[model samples]
Every structure is written in C-alpha cells, then in structure tokens.
Target: MTNLYTGCPKMKEMDGRAVLILFIMLTLVKTEGLVSVTTGSDYVVTRVGENQTISLDVSRAGGEFRVSFNDSTEYLFHKFNNSDLKRVNNNRTLYRDRYRVRGNITSSVFRLTLYNVTTEDAGIYECQKFEGNQRVPGCKQLLIVARNPSQPNITGPASAVSGGSVTLTCSSSSRSLPPDHPPLTMNYTWKRNSEEIQGGGDVSVDGPNLTMKDISREKAGNYTCQAKEEELKSDWSARHVLDVQYGPNTVHFNETHDKVTATEGDPLTVRCSADCNPACTVTWLDTSRQKVTSGQREAVLSIPAVNRSLSDLYTCHVNNTHGNKSRNLKLDIQYGPYTVQFNEIDDKVTATEGDPLTVTCSADCNPTCTVTWWDTYKQRVTSGHREAVLSIPAVNRSLSDLYTCHVNNTHGNKSRNLKLDIQYPPSVKTFSDISINNITRKVDSVSFLCVVDGNPKPSVYLRHDLTNRTYPMTCETLSKSIYTSHQYYECTHTNENFDVFLHGAYSCRAENTVGHVDSRAVVVTVPSK
Candidate 1:
C-alpha cells in the first residue's frame, strides 16, 4: 500500500524511531527532581590549627542520588540527605539522569580534627546532575584562615622591696569558629626586659600566677608575659618595673681615736662611715646640749681651754637616704681641788675648865673635801664643834694663847688664827673684930664677914685639916645676899683663870673655855685665952 510502506529498509528506520521515543520517556521519569546545592560565595575563615565544616545541599536530587567528597584523599567528610526523592512510576530504572555532590574542602573538617590545620583547606563545593552529556550547578566557596589570640592583661607591682615576693598573671580571650573548630589552647612565658628568663631558678609558674621570691636590687627590671598558640602568638603585655631598696651599711664611729685622758683644752674628732644611696650627713652635740649640723660624714669638736666645766656627753648622728643611725661618747676634763675661805666669829672664848670644846674644821680638794684644827697646846682638835676653852683658879694675872681654825673643800685647804686671853683679879672686904684682924679666940662665938669682886662671880670654901673635907662658906649668886648672921662666912673673887679671897684664909676658883685656876689656901685659927 504505498500501501502501508512495507519495505525492509523502511521498516528498519521505523524501528529506530520507536526506540528513541522510549528512551525519551525513561529520561522524563528520572528528571522529576529539582537537584540543587547551597553555600556562601566567600571562603569560610577558621583559626590556625582549628576544625571547620563544609556543607552541600542534595535536596533536589532523586532518591537514588548520593554524594562524594572532592578531597577524600587528604581529608574526608560524611554527607547526610533529608530530601524525599522518588521514581516517577515506581520503577527503579525509570530515571536516565543521575545527580551527586562533592565538597570543595580547603580547611577540611576531618583533617583539621586529625592533623594540625594549616592555611590550606579552603575552596568551592558542588552538586551536579547528569542528563545524557548535560550537567547542573554547585555551591560557591569556603575559606579557611588563621587568627591570633588577643593580648593578655597583667596585674602587680613592677618593682618590689628586697627580700620580698611578687606575683604575675596572664589571661586572654578570643572569638572564632564553632565548637568543631575550637580555638587552640595556649601557654604563657615570663620575661625580664624582653629577655627570656630560662634556667632562672627564682622564677616559677603555676596556672595563671607567676612568682618571683625574695627579690633583690639585681632583680629589679621590666617584666612581661607572652602567650603562644598553635601557629599564632599574641603580642606581649605591658611591662612592669620593679624597684628594690635597702638601708645604709658598714656603720662606723670616729671619736677619741685612741683611749686617753686629757685636760680642759683638748680636741675631739667624730666620724661615721656608711654605705648609702645618697651619701650621709653627720651632726655633733656640745656640752650645753646644742646641736651642730656637721653637713659632712665627720665632725671635729675642740675646746680652746679644757676645764672641769667642759666635761659632757657627746653623740654623733648620721642620716642617709636609706635611714638614720647614731652613737654616743663621753668626754672627761680634769682640774684641781681648792678651798674657798675660813674664819671664826670670836678672838677669845672663856669657859669652865672641865667643859667639852668644839671647833669648825673644813677643807676642799679636787676630788675630796676635808678639814682639821689644832689647839694652842698643839693638840688635834675635833671639827664641827664651835667652842674651845680652858679654866684657871686663883690666878691674879692675865694669860694668852694661840688657837687655829681651818676650812677645806674641793678647791684647796685654808687656815685662820685665833687668840685667847684670860683676865682674873682678887678682891677683899672684912667684917667683925676677931683678934682685931684675922684671928679669933677659941669658942669665943665671934662674928666674921667676907666679900670679893671680879669680872666673873667668886666663891669661897673652908677645909678641915684632919679630914681634908671642903665646905663652901660663901658662893657668888646672880644677885648679892646678906651674910651678917652666919658663923662660917667668907668671900672670894674669880675672873676666868684666877680666884682670890677677901679675908680669913679662904679658897676660890675661876674657869673659862680657854683655862682654869685655883686660889691659894688660907687658914683661920681660934686661940684659947
């Protein structure tokens, strides 16, 4: 039939056409999905030695679609699919198009976890579908980068006193990748003036605090702590300076270079030596407690004329930048002992013969004070007692002698002269005619009277020959009295050294501090007619 064109060659062409149609139908079934992948266009940044994630979207891919990584050899990652892709007619072989995904791993997540990450893992990722010689799109790019930790803050003194301890600390914080790409942990080291302190036995590190113990002047300097992380380190923190101080040393005193004794006019030297940051100043003290700034390390004190009054206590005071110190010294000046003066109020003293005598004895000496005296008889006299005397009885003349007074003190010794003279005279008066004078008859009962006058009052006494017993016939009273009726009545006179009788043999006595005297004996005998 033109007849329904049944030629063999023609038939062959018809069969090829039908097969092409069937192939097209099968492609239609598998192409139902919208296969796609998403990622940022810029490379993702990750700190050095940190893990980073690279993602791909397989949502549009058919159920049979799977993923493979581009960097599986150097680093690898797992891919998860959440899309619900299916065959068009439930025929497993219906789809002729195939799709897949690959990660452009630069800082590969797996390698970052395994090996220390360098700056290399960053690139683009892709999701592709093939339709018989035709392919689809992919995600853009991922970037990996290295970042440093921030600088740390430090706190504490830069300089500390000698023999003291100090603490140093370092801390830092950084913001970077996710948990999978945790920042690198770091270690810190301390330095003195930017120089490493390795092998320094005094330095010790514990956690965040660093300690330097018993610092000295040599330890004074600037200090810093540096933090280091994998492939990256932060700048050093601010520096702190340490200063140590100590007191003056090597103390010395200069005074009396040698031990010796000197008199009033002597020179003295005082010098103090010490090591100080600023040099030292010295001061001197005088006898009157006056202070003189030496302005130098030493001082000289000279006395033009040395004397006992110049003796005093001296001291040296030293002041330095660090502190002050001092010492004391004593100066002794010698002189002689001398007495001031001595004298007595009276030239002569009259007293009873048996009475005690007192005299003043005073003297002076450089180191001691004393006094001594002597009487006219050259006898050592007692001191401090003022009176001296001797007595005489029945002396009708005057007597004189020499006495002495003395004074002594620290200065020197001195003496004074004194003279004592005694005056005594006899007087007489008579009453009654017994034998017409000094005689009376035995048992006659004759009356007799006697009187005497003298500078000192007088007394009379009578003595019996056999018994030697003496009895007072008349004694001087402050006032005169009547003795006309008395049988045994007689008068005598006394003046210091002598005593005298008035009538009929009578005895009397006189006395003074200087001497004593006794009157001559007289007898009155009665005659028997």
Candidate 2:
C-alpha cells in the first residue's frame, strides 16, 4: 500500500492501520489552518510616550496561534505563542519591557499592547495559527505607525528695527528611539497671535527657518512654532514677542491747531509731540537753529513777551534708537501799527490843479493795521487794513490841504502827514486903465496896471502894439492869497517927450512856470493937443 503521507515514504511498508492514524493527524492539521485573524482597522497609529492596544480577532481557530510583528521591510520584531509571549528577532531585547500581549489562548480576541511607544515599534503585525513553522496567507496585517513629535523652540532676536530683516529658527530636542531605528523626519509650522502664518509677501519659511523681511510695526506680535512627525503634532512652543522699533512717524502740536499766533508782550506756549516706538527724544529749535532743551516725546516752547524778533520757524526734532524725524512749527508774533508811512519817496505830494492825486498808506502790524485817511479837519476820508489809498480826482486848491494817514491796531496807533501842493497856470485878472478919465492929452502921465493869479507870483509885463516893445513890470502879492497886483508899464510925455510914443494898444501878460495869460488890449490914445 502507498503511504498516505506524501513526505513519509518509509511508512509505505507499514501497516494500513498506522497509515490511517497518520492521515487522521494530517487532516486535523488542515482543519486548524482555517483560522482567520482580523483587527479593528487596517491601520493603527500611536504617539510616542503613550499607550496603545491593537485588538486581534481569530475566527474558527482551535490551536495555538502565533502573533508576530514585521516592519515595512518584512523583518520580524516580536512574537507571541501559546507557551510564551516575548520580543523576537533583532528587536527582541530592544522592546523587551515596552510590549505585552493580553488574552488567553482560548479566547477569540487578543490584544497587543504597546507602552511608551517609540519610533522603532512602527510596522505591520501578523496573527495566525502556526502550521509547523509555516505562516498562513489569510493572516491580517495591522500596520502600526509610531510617532514622536516635539515642541519647537523659536530662536531669534526679540526686537527688530523697522524695515530690517529677521530670521527665526524652530528647533526641537532630539527624540529618543530604539537602536538601529530609522531617523524621524519633522515638519515645522509657524503661527502669529494664534493665526497660521502663510509663506509669501514679507514672510517666508524654509523647513525650520522663518524669515521676516521689511518688518514694520504691523508685523510686531507674538510668534510660536510647532513640530510634526507623520500624523502626530506637538503643542505650540513658548511665544516669542517681537518688538519693532522705529522713528517718530508724525510730529505736530499736541493741540488741534498746528500754527499759533500771539500778540506782542503776550506769553505763548507751544506743545509738540510725536508717534514713535521706544520713546523719542524731542527738542525744539528756534529760527537761529538753537536747541530748546525739553523733555522727550514732548517739547514745550515757551515765549514770554513775544515780539517780532521771536517770530520764526520752530523745529521739533524727534530722535530715538531707531531713527530721527523733525517737524516745523510756525510762530507768528503780532505787533504794532507802526507809525503810518507812505510808500512814496516823500510824504509831500505835488500835482497839477486838474490832475488826480493818490496817496497810499502802509503800516507794519501783526493783526494788520487799520488805515484811515484824515484831512486837516480830522475827517475820515477812507479806511482799510494794512494799506489804504486816498484818491482825489481833479484835485483843486480845496483838496490840497494837510492830509494824514492814521494807522491803528490792537497794539498801537500812529499817524503820518502828507502835504499836497496844487499848481496852476498864471492868469491875468484885470488891467488898470492907462487913459486918464477916459481921455489922454499930450504930456499927460500914462500908466498900465495888471492883476494876476497863480500858484506862485507871476511876472507881469505890458506890450505896446504900435511901438512893438515890452516893458517889464513889478508885482505886489496879496497877503495869504495867490493873486498879485502889479504896475505893468508906464509912459509919460514931458517937455520934448512926445505922447505919440505912448499912444498905442496895450495889453497885460502874466508869465509863470505853468503857463502865461494875456489880458484884453486897452488902447492908450492922446486927444488932439
């Protein structure tokens, strides 16, 4: 009879009953091969320094089952059987006290517990009935993923100047792992004020290094870093506060108004301030570039009894550790209506009688001076501020009087006089009679008289038509008047002197710088002697 066991050729000569017993034993071994192993899921993940249990279920199993763990390389690390549960292979002693199997061999469910898991314990685990050292193909694979994450420590400058660059390095303490275990790769993430920081713009990241370019006050905040390995994440690291220092951005008066005005002899105070980090040193400078020592961040420029000399540009220089900045403050000091003055070369004005006259008055004052033109009678002719013009059209002697420009302000008042001189052409008013009693006889004395009016006394003369001769004459001015009386010419016939020479048409002429005027002719005739 042929042997029922294929590998037992020597048993071919044995008894058939013995062959039947051997076949029964082989059949029992095949029946036990139907054992199926399963787990809760296909994958298992656990963090380092934590405990995790992988539950296994075996279906229809009636024999001793062997459980073993294999890495991604299919290398066995641990094994458990009905008789004993222990680490095996190269990691046997490495994970000696870190792993345990809980459950009786007769139970349908068994658990593989990992305590204080490490990176080296991550791999696939197989549980199946052992068939004489052969692993069953139906065994389930439990992929265990062990993770070790670390809290990242951020290292960089706590303070940075605005517009500068800074780099923060996220570092972590080395993780402890089993001997001969693969190295753990870690990833880093950055956060600011609890918000995730994205790469781009002024911020960029490379692995564990984070760079911030062109930092500003807006970039100042609390920053933190976290380190991750596989699916395990660590807690956020301690916050690193960034302080951005800068200059005094804007400087101006603390008051609402930027410019201030003060009257002469009045006390004035100007307060200046600036916006800056790390506090700014503020100093006030006068127009002369002299520093006004004061406190930092604010400077009070005080002026006691401000005058025109005190009016100038005041600078508020603000300086800090970051940079420097300055602002200009204008100080206006108002003063008098200084003595009313004329822009003309001289205050005395001369114009023709029929011409127009304009007299402008200008004054120096802080709040602008009020100017008024007053005549000798103290009557207001015109009023204006700073400057005023008194215009007289076709001015005559009546308008030619002592005119004064009065300038006044809150500070003081002043007056300036302007004398107007009016000039006109000479005029012949009247001519005295040259005939005696409307009749002239031979040897009778004859004379001619003329009256003239002009701005200045004019020269009077008489012209004889028949004789074609002119006789210069003398004049007598009327008191406080522009008129004058003069004897123009005289002709007398005495003895051998004939009256024929004196008998002629005579006229009077008055001449001056302006012009000359001639009077109507009066004939000097001698009756028949």
**Deviating ranges (above 4 Å) for candidate 2:** 1-152, 174-181, 185-200, 226-236, 256-258, 277-281, 288-295, 319-324, 342-360, 377-385, 389-401, 409-529
User: What lDDT would candidate 1 get against the real structure?
Assistant: 0.43
Model 1: lowest-lDDT 10 consecutive positions: 19-28
lDDT of 1 by residue, 253-304 (tens): 6534423345434554445455443557767766566885476655555455
Q: What would the per-residue lDDT of candidate 2 be over residues 177-294, giving only the tens digit for each residue?
A: 3322344456789998999999999899998999989988888899999987654578889999988888878887867465677777898888878878888888988778888766
Root-mean-square deviation (CA) per prediction: 20.4, 12.5
Prediction 2 TM-score vs. true? 0.51
The TM-scores, one per candidate, come to 0.31, 0.51
Candidate 1: segments with Cα more than 4 A from true spot: 1-251, 255-260, 272-274, 286-288, 340-518, 521-529
Indicate the residue-level lDDT of 290 in model 2: 89
